[model samples]
Target: MTSNDLGDFLRAHRARLRPGDVGLASYGRRRVAGLRREEVAVLAGMNTDYYARLEQGREHSPSPQILDAISGALRMDREARDHLYRLAETLPDGHRTQPRETVSPMLSQLLDGYTNTPAFVLNPALDLLAANGLADALFSPFGKAENLARMTFLDPAGRSFYAQWHRAAEAVVSSLRQATGCEPHYPRLHQLVSVLTESSEEFAMLWSSHTVYGKTHAAKELIHPEVGTLSLTYQSFDVRGAPGQQVVIYHAEPGSPSSQALSLLGSLNATRRRESTPER
Candidate 1:
């Protein structure tokens, strides 16, 4: 069992809840902002010392009953509950891991067909395996790293590119955590995690929270250096043949400012390509 991860997850979720939020009276000056450890233990219907031990990484395995109670006490949503169970290695269903990192030709063709959309494929570790022209243009500011997590946490351009930089950082870390949990033996994942943890305090803090999630579908606000701010939505799809690969496509509303900006970006890219081509 991932004892340290389980403990960290419990502590983070516990810290996210407040006494008043859980229908308890907030009396006396509190030392912390969130619910206390004893309060969580009481709500979880377990001994305070036992829960404390669990948080201290001394107790690894808790029964499904205890986990359920803790989930309830922490007010976890469906996704968060699934993540907590994963951290405890108590998930009912097993997940498939990526055996290799190659993007299929069919998937590549599909991405290429989406001429107007910014489409790309990523591995479990958020490494870019394949990208269409629009995506290449969109992510050009990230340089040639080809890894989203590293670019977000390590690259200074990431702060300006993602309008909601903090939200983007948290989501990337959470996604990485989910991926690592699914495939614990990926060496590159470990290396990436180690580097980010050691280099970026923000990444370190978010990693310690033990959040786990995939970027399925979400609205994004991005500030492109040339195109300006764009309000776009994206969908992430799992590649069935490749277990841990995801195909992500970004879209904007028709006739909206975002769509116009995207068109302008495409035009600019075409112009640059033409400029680079040799006259025959």
Candidate 2:
């Protein structure tokens, strides 16, 4: 990592906010976007030169209290605050370990038990490690359902499969940014980012934004070739034993048309599986 990575991250996030965002009064027309360096320093309760040196990469180490102050001054969310701490190398003790990517057999079994719900497990880099039958059926349109990032950006069916493709793209990119901060030394994460940046212009633009977000729960709309459009809400849970692995389960409102479509898709998927099996 470059010495200026922390500075660059701070600059990017600072440019994303305005004085009014943090309840600070705006003066005359500002020359630069977002909060000025002095404004941030005042808000963070630090000297202007100190904050400038930190942003200019001259300051190597910042205390936890200082980092927390900067985080609050910038109005960063939990994920973004964590990223800021990681960038400054001031992460709390026991928080710097690498995430274990392995999905346990029990977790795989839990995914299978979802039955009607579409559930899958993903690593920090968005690799789809394991998925239930419904998830497989839901993502069948993709040529490869192995990685959510790849499926959303590189796959032929990606644009059409997602009802809100742009939103999906933004979410994935921000999520990747969060992951990169959490695991800066992970080789696979770097590779994935490099590939996506080279392969997709949209991905490149979003990646450049330096937004950090981790998916917890969200509503999504997907179009299935066999079942048409389905509106679903997905919840992402961190696997207890597996650090980096997250189990995402998608469900539709009970008695809704989307729910009926999901049930139909599950039935069709089961029948297809049965038909493919040999009668021995």
Candidate 3:
């Protein structure tokens, strides 16, 4: 929420690493926790005083060159790099308000109409903006819980639901890292990433990897408890004018058993909904 959210982010990364992680050799008498400030300064190729100044909010607007060095030292992912740059942009007093992003209504309706397929919309931070009924059902548990990244990394049963949980988890965290670059002033996103980076190693590892990716059509394999295995084609379309928004659609192959299963699942949901309604 604060302009310093990104600072908390940087410090969170530091706390996760050990002195030995960045080639720092420590004696047995070491009393402080985590890598010392000097060690990070060395790793970042900056003078200790400057690094300390940056961390304590005494300095602002570091050059791109310095940002890159600090990114490398922190092992920041694509999202983190962008976040570092944004955090670097500041007044001596520190007030930065990023524009609020919104999904187009037409795009939302398009997603709803893609009922045969499971389609959803997302912003840069991977926040679920809109989703069709089927997409809602397939990812309902996650959508209902609120945050996709949290569901993938922090949910115990959620991990078990995805057969390839590790790969999917990495992708989610890494994608979020890319988002940080695009919207460093997003308060909700900043909070979510802050909480995850602190608690999840899976998230931290991926965040530090510096990998980036945009949405693309992909075939995903999923194992639903009730339905067993499903193979589906997932495609993405960018919102007409929304720069960082995307509408992602998932379709089962035509005439494939997966398609049939999705139909059955939809029917089941409809029946459940009908039953829950009053007789009138």
Candidate 4:
């Protein structure tokens, strides 16, 4: 999160593509790996010097049209394109502020209403802000389920819990990258990224890829300690009044084995809660 972050972002993404990847013809063996600056300039319909200036942090402001051209040239996805716009400070006003991390009482109550589903609220940094009973039971194997990124990379159980561990890791890292693009100056997010990058080699590798993504819905397979594997789909909703808070709810197909397993898990959680409560 420096003055040259835009330049760094451009460089990292530019290094990921080859001349053939973008339909550009190759003549001789190139010294560098990915597409050169001149190729990107040609693709984006801009001067090579202007593109180089943008990559060197010499150009501060870039128009939306120019960002779009660059995005198309880089073959960026929707999230990456938005990230590029954000990096260049081309977004409209009022979008640069830090997202609120606190979960509201109404949101917590909504989470509680999903009695049989695994539901939780997460902040911009992927911190677990609030969770319902089933969610608690779902993530009980982690022991420390405070942050999704931390649990996925730092905890040994994560690899076992997530059936597709690498996919999960990539998703987590890309989502964090999207958050970073939104709030580059957030100290807590920076701290979390630093900790994960230092602790986990996979995290560091993915972080350097400069991928950006915002999770809306996805299918996941989780292996529970007590219930075995559960194939579920989760939907993420942004909190109305809160900028960065999101509610994630997981559910399985009706009458499926995974659904039955989730029901059994819910029953087990309820029984455990009752057993722990004292007679009043």
Candidate with better lDDT, 1 vs 2: 2
**Which lDDT tens digits does candidate 3 get at residues 39-84?**
8899988899988877777777677777778778888776667667
Cα lDDT over the full model 3: 0.73
lDDT of 1 by residue, 60-125 (tens): 787767778888899998667867777776753332233468988999999999989899999878
Whole-model Cα lDDT of every candidate shown, in order: 0.86, 0.90, 0.73, 0.90
With a 3 Å backbone cut-off (N, CA, C), the pairs that clash in candidate 2 are: none
TM-score of each: 0.65, 0.67, 0.61, 0.67
- After superposing candidate 4 on the true structure, give the runs of residues whose Cα lies further than 4 Å from its correct spot: 1-95
Q: What's the lDDT for residue 191 in model 3?
A: 84
Badly placed stretches (over 4 Å) of model 2 are: 1-95
Clashing pairs in 3: 77-210, 79-177, 79-178, 82-181
Worst 10 residues of 3 by lDDT: 90-99
Cα-based lDDT at residue 161, candidate 2: 94
* Model 3 ranges with Cα > 4 A deviation: 1-104, 141-145
For model 1, what is the alpha-carbon lDDT of residue 280? 100
